[model samples]
Each structure stands twice: as structure tokens, then as C-alpha cells.
Target: MYKVDKDLLAIQEARIHIEGAKEAAIELRNFTQEELDVVVNKMAIAIKPHLEELAKQAVEETHYGLCQDKLLKNRFACEYLPQQLANQRYVGVIKENYEQKTVEIGVPIGVIVAMIPATSPVSTTIHNAFIAIKSGNPIIFSPHPRAQKTIQRTVKLLKEAAIVAGLPEDGINYMQLVSSTSTNELMNHEETALTLVTGIPKLLPKLKAANKPFIYGGSGNGPVFIERTCNIQQAIHDIIESRTFDNGIVSAAEQSIVLDGPIVEQAKSELTRQGAHFLSEEEAMKLVNVLMKKNGDLNPESVGCSACELAKKAGIQVLPTTKIFIYEQAYVSENNPFAQELFSPILALFVEPNWQEACEKCIELLMEGAKSHTLVIHSNDEHVIREFSIKKPVARVLVNTPSTLGGMGATTNLFPSMTLGSTSLGIVQASDNISPEHLVRIRKVGYGVRTLNDCFNESGNQSLHSKDTQESIEVILRKIINEMKE
Candidate 1:
């Protein structure tokens, strides 16, 4: 009897998916915008019915988030995303400038290799597949090992629905054998046009080393600042709801809270009323060990754990109504674990003297833990809101809204997406909420309205603008084409 090497088998599986998707991509290029839209509509309709099963399976397997919240994520991808992408055009002759004699065509970026996160695997998979098909590109997935079952099930359903609606057989698929070696094969393949990554922070270095272009939706340590003028009740409500949703596993959830000094006492009262459990000094210290690993990275075990669960793990008892865990800190520093993104229903509180100091504190938190991700400001003052908007270096700034819902477009008008393209972390080239539009390249068409001499001779020499001074356009074109052939 003979046994095959698992790494070699995984690598072989990676090649099969890529090769199949490459062939499907060629067929996809001929699809009209109407045809693509029909396919997406069918996928959404088909997947909507299975959201609950997939959500439950995801929670049971990964044990990372609540089933209900996960179901909402599924609905967002299947129902909300399609409506958002409904009227979008991504095919030939997208735009034209009559006066300039130019046109723009939307061309697919070819086959893509995408990595799915364990945290939001099902939703991200569904969303990535839909957008890839809408833009006329076939995609392959490297499912996170922990969520492989859910992801594979999703791909199976998506592929079936897509094929029934005229997508090529391999238009959407996932790796049955997932390994780091196989994932690299997909990313570095010559036929793979782009790599889409989600929630894989540890793979940043490897992603950078790859030769292909990638779009990464990585970690966020987005903080919420409650200014003096903000509605205390509303601000605290949104913060708790957002942070506690899905046990705070979503990357866009608030990591900390900064309060304007004048409202310190009042805000603390509101936070407590809203189910926030402000920890004692000893309790905070215990959770610090549970939340942060010895290497300064997030502790895997604590992720997606509720406040009550995390408290029990840390050897502390908390009220059953506790929705979030808050630790008050006097200073912000790189050495502080609370300054980092904990990825749980845990938050650090900082009080500042004024908007200027609060802004500085938020900036310090971002510099230490996040890059181009998200930030939230709760205030009714127009000037203060404008000031923070002007000074912050983030992708999306949510004002008077919950960070999670607003960032993912649940309660905002931004595009509905599963991938929040966090920039400045590594090789990701885009900062938009990942969508079909980002997966296509724009091709420009020009009619040569003027001669090169018209541009080159603007400094004094007479151009070929007049008939008498012009070389025949046909003759010039023939000469250039003949030279190129030679």
C-alpha cells in the first residue's frame, strides 16, 4: 500500500481549482451586464433560504460568534449586497465622453484567489463569490481550516445556483484540501489575477512576499469617542450594542472609548445603565492576562467570548446582565494591552480634558493598534465633528452611529460588504468596502482627436493642426503599425 503526501495533495488541489477557474473566466468575459445581474439575483435567491443552516453550522464549528448575529451577516451578504449591486454596470461601454471622443469599458480582473476568515467565513464567502461573478470573474477560495465545513458548504450551494443560472461549472469553488502550502499556490499562480484576503493578520508577511496583487480586509482597533455635546444615552447605547453584537468578533467593533472630561461622571453612569461592566483594578489585571498572549498578540481563546464568559475565565464573577467589559486606563501606550484590538466584548476607557486631548488619545490608540480601518465620534457639535474628520487617517468615520453596523453598511448608506479593506497594514491596494466595482479594471478608448505634434509643438513650433502642415493620419498610422510588426 502507498500513501500520498498531504502537502502535495493540497498543492495539486489548488492547481485544479485555479486551472478550472481560468477556463471559466474566459467564458465569463462574454456575459452581458444583464446576464451577470441575472446570475447574482439567482444566487441571492438560492442562498437566502439556507442562511440559517449555514449560520448554525458556522457557530457550531468555529464557536466564535452568536448564531443570530451570524444569520444577520448571511442576510446582509445574500439580500442586502445584491440590492446594492443591482444597478451597477461592469461591462463594455460603461461611460463615454462625446466631446473628448473617449469611452471607458469595464473589464474583469480575471480569476481571483481569495482567503476566507474563520470569524465571518460564511458571509464573506457568499459576498466574495457574488461580487466576483457580478464583475465577470471566476473566483477560488482557500477556506480557513476552522470554518472549512461551512465555507465548503457555501461554495457548493453557490456553485450549483450559479451554474444553473449560466455561470461556468467552476465559476465559484473552494479548496477541499486547505493548507498554507496550497493557499500559497493559489495566490502565486500565474493565472490568478488578484488575491482577496479577509481577517488573516498573521499571513500579512506571506501576502507581501507573493507576486500577485491582493486586497486585504484585516484587523481593526477602531475606537469610539463620546464628546461633551453628544447624546450620552444614545452614544452609550450604540457603543454597547455594537461592541456586544456577535460577542465583538467583527473587525469594525469599537475597541475602546474616549470620554470628554466634563461628561466623565455622566458617561460612566450611562455606560453602566446600558449593561457595561466597568471592571475593578484587580479584575482588569486578570482579564489583561486572559485577553493578551505572552507574545503581545490577541489571545485566541478569549475571542468572541461574552463579558460573563470572559469574567468567569479570568476568575471573576459578573452580573448575568453584563453586556460588555470595560477597563478604565489613565494613559495610552504601546505597552498597554487594552490599547490593542481584543476582538471580544471588551473595551478600554480613557477620559480626556477636551476634544483636542480626546482626539489625541484616539489617534494614539489607532497608531498603536490599527491602521486605515474605522473610527466613531459621538457628538452634535458640527465644528468638532468636522475637526475630527479632517484630522483622522481612517477609511470610514462614523458619526453618531455604532461602529459595527455603520462600518458594514447596516445602518449607513455605504456599500454593503463583508470585507472592510483596512489599508496601511500591508500589500492591500484598496481602502474601499470591497465590491464588484473594485474587482474590475477600467479600459480607456481614445479616438485620437488631435495629433502628437499638436501637443509637442505647443511651445512655438507649428503643429499639424492645419491641413497644410499635417502628415496624412492614415500614412502615419500605417508607418507606426508596420514598424511594430517588423
Candidate 2:
């Protein structure tokens, strides 16, 4: 009876927010591109000084990830994201391709539902809110139960700044009263445009049941392949750095390392030198159970731990300087926790004869682990690199860079984003790093380039074709310009 009352209260809260958000979305449609960018910029500036504080608070509240690393993530959202977003237009008429006799207008997708992950609460919230407002969409955030205080604090901070900078009063919000029922209410709400879930794969069924479009940033157990011809020391360095960043909480981080057969020993030596502690057979088995729950899934409790911390939990002794916990893995299966996403500074090592067999092994690991997300290759050989790129089912294929930094656009050319959209994981929505452009629909305007004579002509006739009608495109364009001026 008590639970029912709380659920009802939560539902009420969701409905209120959704209603206000719908109104806000309507108001936002009248905002020009510059107006939306101003609100986003103001919010980003207001949140800039508190980035470190929020990172600390997030770490303190969730007990996940290193505080310093989380700070870097927050800075990435503040620093890199804004520079990229500033020049890009996401509101009103965004493009006019005069040559194609077409124009593209950016239309807001309406109210959005954002599910902030406990693992990346602050960074993901900032990203979701920034992009949402940038695209002129009102957004309601649902904080993860574990990181409620951190996420709520972030949303509160951004909302205040956004409104002060001319955003609608109810344009941005977060659910202080969170429950499964309440979250479901938001997802299923008639006003909810789409649900953007970051690092929470469990909600897919509920999101699907809602019958609304959703973008998901789910699991990643992508393999980082080090070819025989690659620089052994540099490859090992990239892998260790990637897997240990934020204690491996980032989904794009390397979870497995696939090595070509001839250079296996040398690469292993290099990895050890670079602080990856290889576990013995007995030690590996002991840690397997610790990393797995009773249902044979990756244990959530073991996620986002440093190498030393993960080692301690598994009752294995290791030097404090250890940067990664390494386990030599042969087979890929559900029962093998090494084959799964440990989500900590732990990696499964695989040895294959060549790039062809290595590619096969990577596919097996991807299937057994994260379904499909990201893959990395370290090699100077363009042929091998091209082959890996062509064959992988993952969304992003990073080359010659650390997977975490490269995948997130810090070291690569990907759009700066926290939401690494999992393509082929079910949704056909966004298969790249999500940005403001993904939050809105493109309204294309194409002028008529042909008449009924040209269209219905069964016989090949140039006179009845678009060549004669090509002159009309300029007239149509001038009329469109006149309409815009009016």
C-alpha cells in the first residue's frame, strides 16, 4: 500500500513535467538558431566552474570511477563539445543547396526523455542537456537511482542557467521523484519525443514497449587488435591507457586485446612493462567468479574499479602500480566472465595466427560480449587496417589510437559526445557519436524539376525532360527567398 502511494506520486511528477515540457517544446519552435545557441552557451558557461565539484560529488555519491578522470570527462563536455557545436546550425533553416534545388530546415524533435547513467552521471547529463537545448528540444532527465544526488544537482544547475539565458522555464528538468513506474510514465507519455538512454541496456524492453523512437548507448566489449607489424610498445601503451581511463567505465574503452601470433611474446612483455598484470590460471579463475553474478552476467558491483581495486576484490595480490588486470582467454562464451565486459581495468587476451584469424576472433568476442559496438586496430599496414575496417560489425573502428580517447573524439575526428550510439543493437537511429543534429529532424524542401510530360514519358525524349525545366529552379528559389523575407 505504501509503495503504491509513492508510485502514484512519482507518476504525478512525471506527468506534470511532461506537460510543461510539451508546452516548452512548442515555445522553442519559435526560437531562431542563434537564440538556442545562446541558451546552451550560457548553461555551459555557468556549469564550467563547478565541473570539478560535480565530478567529486558524482564519485562520492556513486562510488564509481576515479574523481580526476571524471573531471577530465566533464571538461571534455565543456571544452571540446562547445567549440564543435558553435559553428554547426541546428534550428530554423540550416541548409540551402541551390545546386540541388533543395533546402534543409532543422526541426526540433520535441520533448526528449534522457536516462542518465550512474557510471557517467555528470558528463552524460551535461551532454544530453546541451544537445537537447541546442536543437531547441525540451528535455526531462531521469536520474539513475545510484547517482541521484549527482545527476539531480547537475540538472538543477543547468536548468537555472538555461532559464536565465532565455530558455523556457520548463524547458529542462530532472525527476526528483524517481521510480520504475514514474520512468515508464515519462517514456510512454504522449509528449515524449524520444528516449535517450546512456549506458543502461536493461531499459530496452521498456523503451520498446513504449513504442517511441529511442537512441541507446549500451554495452561495448570491442576487441583492440595489435598486428604483428605494429609498434609493440606503442600498441600496448594505447591499450593500457584506454582500458584504465575512468577505471574502464567508458563503454568505448578496450575490454579485450587480440594479438598476432608471432609477436605475442614481445607484446605480452611490453604490456607487462606498461603495467598490465597478467593473472595466473588459478588467479584468473578466482577473479572470474568475482566478476560474474549468479546469473552468469557481468557483475555491476565490480564495474569502474582500478586495477589494484579490482585485484583486491578478487583476492589477488598485485603491485599498486598495476594499470590493468590481464587474463589470458581462449574461448568466448557466456559462462566466461573474461569474455564479458568487466567494465573495470581488466582485459581478456587472445592470440591469433594472423589478421584474418584475428578478425574472426574479434567477431566471436563481439558476439559473445556486447553484441556490436566498437573495434580498434593498431597497425601501420594499410591493407590489414582496411580489411579490419571492412569486416567489423561494430559502429566505430578506431585506428592507431587509444580506443577510449579516439572513440570519444578526444584523439580522433568523431563528434565530441558521451553517448556512443550502439548501431545494429536494435535501433536504426544514430550509429555515430550523438550530437545536436541527431536530436532534430531534417525538413527537406525540393522544388519540382520536371513536368508530367517528363515524368510519364515512356520513350526517351530529352525535350520533355528536366533540361527545359531547369530554368524554373531559379524562379522557384527567388520565390522562396521572397516568402522568407515576408
Candidate 3:
């Protein structure tokens, strides 16, 4: 009997994992929409009540993010996400008219590999699992090493629930023993029908080479402008919560605060009240010199570290209650590292002479890695909000809300999402919240001449049944206004 080398055994194990997923996907394709809905509802119910507990476990395991914030993210997925898909028909011949043959169908894309980040572990898993289940596709979750325990436990519960709901036993799986070697192989594997990767910005280059249809996580370097007319105190509070929640680890969290001249002082005062420590101008300049390269690059170490951490390293004492540490600088200088996405409670505050200057600075940051990230603005002036919303390249734009909570659909009415898409990079083409509905693809059926005519007569202009013409009028007016501005 030939001995089996350990390396060869690992490869074989990966093969088995991939094969199991493939088989599950095929089995899922044979299921009815009713069966898929049962799986969806069952999984949602299974995870709903345990959100708070799971958040605690996640923070303990990953050592990132606040338990309370994670709790909000988890509950959002459990209650809202499923509810969004609840009444929607995922699998069916959606027919405008059966005889006319105007129909659309939902088709499952076999197996998917969802890569969960350490920052938002359990929440990502829950979201991915729910989406996969709703779309009638089998999924394998690959958690970042920092969050293995939490991810493993959740996946275990979800799998069991799916089985109990009469779904295939292997409908959902997890890589209990995941590593770079395994993940690289899994992404490149021919069977991974779709891949959802969320991690370091550097990982995108590798994912791009995988030759598979994938959705990537957005960078956290979102920029926001606080126009002078904005409610300075309210904007400041919102910024603090968004930037510091979970210690600034959310990938979609705001990075830099571009403050308009008139409100800079007021904004700073409000931020101070909310536990933010602003650096004196001299200290800010010194920190900028030390943290930035002569060519304007942000030092690599400063990317995700808090200001207090940076200050301590620079041989200075930082205040204890400093929820956010600030660096005051004239502008992004060459060799200064201001364009990076720092996943911490540090924010770069740039004081602009006017709205034009603020807009320019915000644009520069977005050009760095924020293609699909978020941009926030605070202004009561409709013109300011309108101009910025139309001109800014980032995906989501929040008006009069804190950048973080507002973008996440928390304090404001925006849809809750941990993952923000950057449309600029073409990775995410929209500003809408990232949801499981994204996992589905539609198929359409067309009608023949005779059938079309018969249906038109039977329906008798049913398209005219809409409530009002107000929405259409608004669209036309907005378009006209945008063109006139141009």
C-alpha cells in the first residue's frame, strides 16, 4: 500500500469540499421555489434571536468591532434582509401574460464561495448564507482566520437548520481549516460558480485573476463634505459614531472629514463633545510630516491605526477618552499618506477655504481606492447637496446624517449594509445596499405575435393602473434641472 503524503491529502480534501458544493448546487436547482423559501425562512428564524449573543462571540473571537454595533448589523440581516426576499418571487415563471409568453425565470448559479472578513465575521456569513439560500444555490463560507470560531459556530447552526427544513444536508458548508493555500485554490477552482471576496484592497488583484464572476467589498476611505450650512453639531456626532464604531473597522466607514470654513470651529467643538481630540495646528503639521512621505504617500503603518496610537508611537501622550484622534493639515501633500483607507478611529480633517476646495479634496481621496465606497454631505442647502450628489463619483451619498450610520442605513433610512460598493472601480455598479438579491440572475420568455395580440385585448391597457403621474413628473424635472446646471 502506497503511503499518502499529507500535502496530497490536503489537496484531496479540497477536491472533496469542492465536489460536495457542486453536488449541492445541482440538487438545489431541482428544488421548487416553495422549498427554497422554507429554507430561507428557517435559516432566518434560526439566527434571529441569537444576534446579540453572536455579536458578543464575534467580538471576542475577532477582537474587532463593538458588540453593540455588530448586534445591529446581525439583526438587520436577520429581520430585514429575509423580509426583503420574503414576498419576492425568487423561483417562478413570472408572467405578464402566460398566453402572451412574457415571462421571466430565476436560475441558480451552482456553488458560491463567500469570503468573510475578520471585521464583520458573523454578519457577513449570515448575509451570504441567507442570499445563497434564497437564490437556491449551495454556498461554502471561508472566514478570515481571525474569525474562525464565530464563523464555524454560525455555519454549523445554519447547516443544521437547513437540513431540518428538508434542504440537502450539504446545502451550506464552511472551511473549518482554511488557509491562503486553500483559499487561492478555491477561488481559482473551476467549480466555484460565483465568489464574494471582502478583505484587504490588495486582494482584489488576485480575485480579478480568478476568472470567475465575483462581488468585492468596498474600501473604507469614503470622503464626506460638511458644507457650512450643515448642522455642524449633528454632523460632528454622526461622523464620530461612524468613524469609531467597532473601532473604525467597517470597510464602508468614513475616512476623511472635509470641513467647510464657516463651520470648522463649530464642527470641531461638537466633535470634542463626542470624545474626539483634535490636534493643535502645530502638532497636526508635525504629525503630518512624520506620517506622510515627502512624495505625499501615507505611511503604511498609519493606514488603520488610531491617532492616539500614532501619537503614542511618536513619543507623545494621548488622552484616555479620545474616541477619535485628528490630524490637522493644510491639504494632502505629496509624500503625505492621506489617500489610504485607514480602518481605525483616526480621521484626516482638511479645512477648505470654500465648498469648491472641499469638493476638490474629497475627489482626490475617492480617486485613491474609494471607487465603490461612500461619500457623505451635510447641507440644508438643496443646491449644495444636489450639486455634490450629481458630481461626486462615490456610490452612496448621505444628506444631513452621520456618514457611518447613515450610509449603513441605521440612523437614517438608507438600507443597512456592511459592504459599500464603489461604482468608480466598476466592481460595484450601483449605490444601492448590497443584499442577497444580488446573487440572483433572471431568465426571460418572449411572446409570439398571436399570443401578444390576444393578451393585449384581454388585459386592456393594464399598464395604466399605476397610482399617480407625480413620480414621472419628478423624474422629468430632475433631469431638466441637471441638464440646465451642466
| Residue 437 in candidate 2, Cα distance off native in Å | 1.3
RMSD of each: 6.6, 6.7, 7.4
Tens-place lDDT per residue, model 1, 1-486, is 899899999999999989999999999989999999999999889889899999999999998989999999999999888988888898777899999899999999999988999999889999999899999999998999999999999999988888899999988888999898998899889999999998788777888888568998868888889999989999999999999889999998998999999999999998888898889989988998898888877788888888999988899888889999888999988888887777799899999999999998888877775565889999999999999888887777899999999999999998898899885766676886888888999999999865566653454356467664455555667898999999
Shift of residue 372 alpha carbon in model 1, Å: 2.7
Instruction: Point out where model 1 deviates above 4 Å.
Output: 450-486
Model 3 residue 378 CA deviation in Å:
0.7
Give each model a TM-score: 0.92, 0.92, 0.83
Q: Which ten residues in a row have the lowest lDDT in candidate 1?
A: 454-463
Model 1, residue pairs in steric clash: none
**What lDDT does candidate 1 reach at residue 181?**
93
How many pairs collide in each candidate, listed in order? Answer: 0, 0, 18
- lDDT by residue (tens digit), candidate 3, 1-486: 988665555456666778998888878888888788898889888877778888999887766667888888888777877766676666655445656658888887778888888777887788788878878888888778778889988888888899999888778988866667677777888998777766556568777777567776656578778898877777777788788777787877787889889877788888888788777766666666556667765554443455567677655566776788776667665344544666677788888989887888887877665353778888888987888888777777888776767776766766556565556444342346666556667788776664432433444443433444445446768998999999
Name the regions of candidate 2 deviating beyond 4 angstroms: 1-4, 454-486
- Two-way TM-score contest, 1 vs 3, winner: 1
